[model samples]
Target: MKLIIQIPALNEQETIAEVIEALPRKVPGFTSIEVLVIDDGSTDDTVDIARRAGADHILRMGCNMGLARAFSAGMEEALALGADVIVNTDADHQYCADDIPALVRPIRDGEAKIVVGARPIRDNESFSPTKKLLQWFGSWVVRKCSGTDIPDAPSGFRAYSRDAAARMCVVNTYTYTIETLIQAGRKRIPMTWVPVRVNRVERPSRLFRGMGEYIRRSVATILRVFVMYAPLRFFASLAALCALPGIVGIVRFLGFYLSGDGSGHIQSLVLSSGLMAMAMVLMAVGILGDMIAANRSLLEDIRARDLLGATTRRRHDATILKLADAS
Candidate 1:
């Protein structure tokens, strides 16, 4: 099987070469392995360093297209080249290349369509408190959205089969690890996680900058995933959050009115009514979104079926051609 290793790099001039060089040259079940470096408009010499490190293919973006777009482009290219499986790793050298085999083994064994490298956070490793909280919250949100128990849903190091790669529709450019998992879960693709040790990188992480940014990005990712995969749950949760306060207010107003206290009845009634109205509106929107998600899923299913049929036909044709040549 053809296996392609894709690394998405953005201004990783200092450590890109080492990361590429560290990849294993050979592995079981893979007849050939190709290393692809996606340069996301790095101003530094990232492209040159990757070329020197013996990359089989280099995809250069004209400007900084962000991680999601770069990754999508790389996966598309690999799929077009007939890669049976693709592995994604960061160019910052945070993930160990030695763990690639472990990451891909489950997929090769037919146990999973996607496998994620879960990073171990050691006691000695220090991260900001806010960053830690965001990570925890993000994992929880992903679990809720995907209905899958993911220990480390935001891990960037992952392996995907051709089916999973082709089926994913990533909207977020900054972060897509969690979103991809949610999408896979929605598509009924089997996924597994393998624990891997995280190595310290030479460059600072973009995710470790500040608490506010981390929280904002994490929330955005969660919401995006919710919309993409489980719009019903997303909208229902919002409606419930909005309507809960109104429900309580209405109950309190009724209690007061029944208790012969009519002084603040008008104000309470107005507030409760307004809250109920907003909740209803949100619920309607959520229902509409759920319908849209259903339609989208049906379309995706048809597309996937057509693609698989085409692939099977091509393989059969190739076999026939080989037999004719032999005769």
Candidate 2:
């Protein structure tokens, strides 16, 4: 199998070389391996460093286009080069290269379409406490939503078969990792995880800088993933949460009135009425959002089907033409 190892980097000149050097030179199943470094508009000598490290291909962006776009570009290139599998790794030398073979093995064996390198955060003290907390919460949320137990839903180090990679259309730039896992689950792609060792990086993470920001972004990503895949569940949960207080208030108020205790509870009445109204409004909005999500999902399915059919037709036509020429 032809494999492409993609390293998306921005201003990682200091650690990129070490990261490249750490990658294993040979794997058992891969017939050809190419290293592709995507320089996402770094003012530093990241491109030069990547070239010096013997990267087979380099994609340079004119300006910092963000991680998601850089990864998309790199995946497109890998696909164009007819890569059967693509492995994504960080440029900060945090991930262990020795674990790459294990990560790709499941895909090669046709057991999984995606394999994630689950880094044990306990080994590194460099990760902020808040970041760790957010990761835990995010993983829990993903597990609950996707019905899949993932140890590291936000890990950037992962391998995807060409089929899985082709299906991804990432919309979020910063939180693409979370979206990727969620989308893969939605696509019914078999996913497996392998434990990978991680070390302290030379440069700190650019994404999770502060505790509050990290938490906020992670929560937002979780909500976004829920909306993307299961909009009905997301909205239904929101509606239920909003209706709980109102339902409780009404039950208590009615019980008191029926027992001839109190009918002049204006506060309770107002609170219940307001809450019920809010709940109804939320439910209405949820219904609309669910409809939109359904339409979007249908469109995406149709597009994927069309693409697959076109590819199959072209392959058949080419084969027939080759047979005619041979005859």
Candidate 3:
């Protein structure tokens, strides 16, 4: 088995070396362990330092893509390079390197396809009160969208089995953490979480500026997930919302007409008709979106199978080459 730890970096020349050096060369379940550094077009010397710190692979994007793109790129590279299990951690060393074994244990034991590290957010002294509350709320929204009971969703530190990693498709450009979890849950991938340690972040987050922005962005991800995975449900809810007011207006108009004041209720009838038309349009949209979602599911299944097969063949060929060399 091969385990590859991937760290996605931006302008993190300060901590990339420490992050790469701290990774363990040997884990309990894997014979080979390697470090992969993904430099997201850093202006600094992140690539050179990561190489000096014993990084086995370095992938540099042509331009400064966001974290989400960087992560997706590294994941694909690791899978192609025959990583049986992949661990994703921060470039700033926010997650403890010693805990990598625990992170991969769930996947190794066949317990979960995806395993996320649950940080002690409430007890962390680095978080302000408002930030803590926002974390809780953002996680709550993610839980609803993902339908998974994992305690933490915003934490980027996670481990994925080959199958799970291969199946992931991240459409969100701002962040991958929340969207990936939602994708896993909607796709019915087994998921679990274990408690992990974290170092206090010395610098402010580059992801977002304020807690309010966090909530807003998280909700946006939820909406996107809902639209992508559960489009019928989302649009149906909207149709129902429109139907309510339309129904009320129609009932009011009927009551007035039956009471001999029908002339004055013309405006009410017109409004009800407009609302009902809107409701019908929304319902039609929901049906069309559901059809598209079904097709998307089928396509994703085919893609996943093809990718997994390619990865498996690569691993097998690599093993044979090693044996031939040894002989």
Candidate 4:
């Protein structure tokens, strides 16, 4: 088995080399270890530093596409490089490199296809009270959506087996941490978590423009994932909500009409009719959304097959070339 440690970098010229050099040179059940850096249009010397630190692969983007894009690119490159497992870490060096082995242990032992490096969010001193509350609330929401009991849903430290990597498709441009956990749960991928250590704050996050922007994007991403995967439930709940009020309105209208005040209850009839019409519309929308969700699932399957096939063919071609060289 081969493992590729991938770091998504923006402008970490100072810490990128340290992050790369700190990676484990060898791990059990892996024949080789390779370091990959995704330079997302870094204007600094990050690429140079990573190269100097002996990164086996560096994927440079045309422009700054954000962490999600850089992460996806690194995963694709790693898979194409015949990596059996891929470990992703931040370039800021906020996460401890020493915990990488424990992070990937479940994957190596065949217990999980994806492993999340859970961090002690409560014990972190860098987090403010508001930040800590938001973290806990966001993680709880993600757990409900993903059906996974992950403590640190926002942590970037994670490991994915080839199968899990191939199946990954990130639609959110803001972040991959939360969206991926939700996706894995909905897709029924075998995922687990391990406690990991983190270092002190090295630098401010470059991913978010500000706290408000981060909150907006995070909420949008969460809602998108929920609606995309559970459209029927989402729409049906709204439909039922409207229907309940419509039923109550109709009952009140009936009571007024039976009391010989039918003319006075005309407005109630109109309101009830409007509510019922809205309920019907929402139901129709729910069905349409459910159909679209099904089509999306089929597309995901096709994409996964394509990725797995490409990886397999790449490995096969490399093997043939090596045999020819030996001959």
Candidate 5:
């Protein structure tokens, strides 16, 4: 099987070559092993350095689009290249490159379609105490939402089978790590995580300005994915929460009316009516959202099928051409 390893780099001129050099040159795979570098609008010598470091493919972006978009682009190129599997790692070389075989072993064994390299968050010396706690909390929340016991939800190191790679669609521009897990879980894609080692911090993360910003963006991504995946359930539960209390208050106001002195309870009636109206709106929104989600799913399926067919045709054509040349 042809396995392509993708590194998403941005202004990493200093360390891009080191990251590329550390990559394993051989694995127990069927055939070729290639390196694909995604240059995310680097103004520096990152592209040139990567090229000199023996990168098989360098997909360059005109401007910085963020990690999620770069990842999506890399996956598209890998698919078009007829890769049997794809592995993603950071350009900072934070992850241990030696563990790549272990990372992809499960995929080779048919145990999972997607494999996440879990980090020892708490034990990492580079993480501050607060960062450690935040990491734990974030991973816990992701575990609950994803129904997968991934200890490192934000790790950039991961492997995807060709089928899983084709089905992946990163809508969030913030990051793909958490969003991909949530999508795979919601879609019932088989996933597994393996423990992996991480190197010391070479540079601060450029993805966020600070921990506060990261938390804000991460929470927004989680909520957005949840709504997109299960809009009806999410909004219906919210609607019930508002409407149930309003119904109770309205019933109490009716009792007050029958008792002769309902004038004092006018405020309660107004509040109840407002709440019921809000609940109705939420329910309507939920219904509309469900319809939109269905349409999005249909479109996603169509796109996946089209890409898969194209990849297959390209592979067949390449084989026939090779055979003709040989003859």
Candidate 6:
């Protein structure tokens, strides 16, 4: 088995080397361990620093795409490198490097295909009281949305078994963490979480400008994923909202008509008809969205099979070459 640790770095020249050097060179349950640094169009010397710190692979992007795109690219490259397990961490070094073994242990033991590192949000001294409450609320919302009891939904520290990584398709440009979890939960992927330690980083977050911006972007991502994964339910709820008001209007019109004031109630009937039409339209859209969701699932499955097939063939060819050389 081979493990690849991937760090998506931006302008982290100051700390990228330390993050790379701190990684464990020989982790248990894997014969080879390598580091892959995803340079997301860093204008600094992050790539050079990572290479000096002994990074095995550096996948550089042409421009500064967001973390979601960088993560997707890293996963693709790691899979192509024949990684059995891929561990994604932050270039800011906020997560403890020593905790990586714990993250990978669940994958190695076959307990889960995806493992998330839950941080001590409330107990961390670096987090303000407001930040702590926000973190708790965000995690709670993600749990309800994902159907997974992950206490740290926004934590970037995570490990993905090759198979799980292959099936992951994150479309949200804001962040991949929540979108991926929602996808996995809806897809019924086996997942587990482990507690991990966090280091105190003095630098501000590069992902967002402020708490308000983060909340706005994160909420948008959650809503988008919810719609994508559970479109029928979302639209059905909207339909219900419209239908209830329409029904009330119609009942009011009927009551007036029975009381011999049918002429004045014609306006009420017209309004009710409009609302009912809206309800019908929403339901029709829900049906269409549900069909699209089903097709998306099938395509993901096909992509996963293709990735695994290619990995297997590469391994077979490597084994044949080794045998021939020995003979």
TM-score against truth, every candidate: 0.86, 0.85, 0.96, 0.97, 0.98, 0.98
What is residue 112's positional error in candidate 4, in angstroms? 0.8
Model 1 root-mean-square deviation: 3.0
Candidate closer to the true structure by lDDT (higher is better), 2 or 4: 4
lDDT scores of the candidates, listed in order: 0.82, 0.83, 0.90, 0.91, 0.93, 0.94
Query: lDDT of model 4 at residue 191?
Result: 91
Off by over 4 Å in 6: none
lDDT of 1 at 44: 90
lDDT of model 1 at position 34: 95
Best by lDDT: 6
Which candidate, 3 or 6, would have the higher TM-score against the true structure?
6
**lDDT (tens digit, per residue) of candidate 3 on 112-195:** 989999999989888899988878877887788889998888899999998998889888888999889989999999999999
Which parts of model 4 are misplaced by more than 4 Å?
Answer: none
Q: Judged by lDDT against the true structure, how good is candidate 3?
A: 0.90
Q: What are the per-residue Cα lDDT tens digits for candidate 4 across 231-251?
A: 889999999999999999999
Model 5, 251-271: lDDT tens digits are 999999999979999999999
lDDT value, candidate 1, whole model: 0.82
Model 2 — TM-score against the truth? Answer: 0.85
Encode model 2's per-residue lDDT on 5-116: one tens digit a residue.
9999999988899989888878889999899999899999999989999899999878988888999888777776667899999898888888999999999999998999
For each predicted model, how many residue pairs clash, with residues at least 3 apart or on different chains?
0, 0, 0, 0, 1, 0
Model 5 Cα RMSD, 1 decimal: 1.0
lDDT for model 6, on a 0 to 1 scale? 0.94
Q: How close is candidate 5 to the true structure, as a TM-score?
A: 0.98
Model 1, 224-321: lDDT tens digits are 76776677777788888878888998899889889998576878778878888888888898889889888888887776666555666666787899
**Model 5: residues with Cα > 4 Å off, grouped in runs:** none
